[model samples]
Target: MQTMRPNPSRSDHKAIALMYLAFFVLGLVGSMTGPLVPALRHIFALDFRQAMAAQWLVLVVIGALAWPAARLMQSWGVFRLLCLALGLMAAGCLAVSFAAGSGYFASVLLALAVIATGTTLLQVAGNPLTTALGAPEKSHARLALAQGFNSLGVLGGVHLGSSLMLGQDAAQGVQLTYGILAVLTLAGLAMFLCGGKAFPTSALANETAAPSEALTSRWAWAGAAAIALYVGAEGAIGSIMINFLHQPHVLNLPMAEAGRASAKIYWGGALAGRFAGSWLLTRYRAPRLLGLMAALACALCLTVAVTQGPMAGYAALAIGLCNAIMFPTIFSLTLARSKAPASAVSGLLCTAIAGGALISILVGEMADHTGLAQAFLVPLVAYGLIALFAALKPAIWPQG
Candidate 1:
């Protein structure tokens, strides 16, 4: 097994700042599906399963592109890859803005695929870069801190996206919102172009393993499964939250208000937890804390499954807090333990995120057939599996 030794000098503050900005924008763009669901449903006359197809498409593109993106990063370097991704995201946003009221659902999906492609590249480059920009011992804490900024982006994105895209004039709102996002993405692209030299050019540039090498490592497969389950559970819960809260048995808020509440309570909890988790990772063992959070998230999902009214709604929302540390912790822990190259392992992990689409589709089917509350059983099982993974000895501590 080869250990990824972090060079303290490569941990440049400018590079770290750039990574944070990238993560923040990624969060903002990545979180659009949940807030945009109601508008999409209204526009397309979609059912639960149909509405979920939007998210499915996004994750599917991400999975499909993860490997290629990793290979490209290996050759082109992170800075160039990031620049390309940002440009693609901006172009995709502009296309979406144009297609908003054109009444062509396929156009929207196509635009979203483009956006997902950009997002895949960003994640492929950003995750390893963040880890490389700091000490290996502090990888967990540093990644969590970056993810905190990501959550901050999610918090603001959800609020503004929901308010704009879920309004009375949904089409106009979509056009205006995405148009603004296009401009913002272009601004990020300009920043990266001008500050390209600030990024550590040599970081992770030596990881030349074929993607198949990652498949041979048990740690890679195990970590992939954990990432899949975590992403699936989180996506399923978030995708259905607004509709769940709008149910007669729950808060019964309007679609717009429900979206706002989901933003405030659900994603907001994640924001707080990520910041807090960043600090806690420095003081605690990463896997132990991950296990604790997964267990609590599982318990909360159970409450949502069996309970009714505000209790169930809040319980579902509270899962975000428990989810805050899971992704970064699982990722950093896997990197520490895996025998595979960092790029290969990262590509595998990002590919696993496509499981979110599958889980979300299942939840949608369950919501259509078994009822929304019972649909939480899917994520509950996922969180339980993650907890079990965390309890494994190899996962609990780094190998020598």
Candidate 2:
């Protein structure tokens, strides 16, 4: 592994700013296709299962690749790794554009999976980088702030992509959308390469611990499971919100309007809550905060499931606020207890992102069978589990 020696006297502000910028852009890239999921489903005449599967495929690839990617980040400098990932994102977008334009839905979906692979790699590298950018005691807060920027990116992505691609046929509006994303990713890549040497590397290197060591930590494995459930529930709610609103008993809003609502109102709550949690973490204990958030999330999900009309839909949106801090809080807490293998342990936790794909798909399945409102129940289970972990702080991390 390359040794990272920072010049303590030099200003790291520029490097930190650039790193956050990279994270924000990654968020945008990940979310740009969100509102378009339903549109793509319609364009390809896919069923609910198939559409959900498409999204799942992307997440599964990301989860599968996260640990290996983390090792690569340690081997390569953060800048080079970030740039390469961004380039992959751009290329994936371009590839998807061609696939969509050429009328190959499967190929387009696969291309999207490729894009997610890049985004996942960037996220795995970026989180720890941001934590190292500031004081160790407040690393959790800094990470939350960084994630807040990620939320902003998601907001921007939804608006831009919706305006360009939401209502159009797959080929008509998608090409331009992907083109714009490709350009953004390319720009990010160039900037990262230009300033690659400035950012500091994290000290929690996993090179010493064999991959099996990461798997051996029970807390890490439990944490990974927690993350998976959390993401699955979050993704399911976020991804299907528009569709749910379109149902007869729910918001019954126009598709475009509902998409906007999901992005701005739903994710907007997530953004605000994360920023607030960043500050709050300075004053409170991690386990306590996580437990409270998890409980609130459970209540909100229940409310959404039982209520009807805009009230229920809005409640679902509000749940985003409760969810905002859970990921980072759980992450920091899990790593804090790891004896000497945080990096590898972190890798195990990251793999839980597969929950996003699986949980969301289950929600979609329920929506298909029962009603859109009932899908909220799927996330209810995940939130309850997170709450359990918060209270118990279990040790179930896996070994290689």
**Clash count, one per candidate:** 0, 12
Point out where model 2 deviates above 4 Å.
1-11, 201-207, 393-400
lDDT of 1: 0.86
Over all chains combined, what TM-score does candidate 1 have?
Answer: 0.96
RMSD of each: 1.8, 3.0
lDDT of 2 at 140: 79
Indicate the residue-level lDDT of 271 in model 2: 84
lDDT of 2: 0.76
How many collisions between residues are there in candidate 2? 12
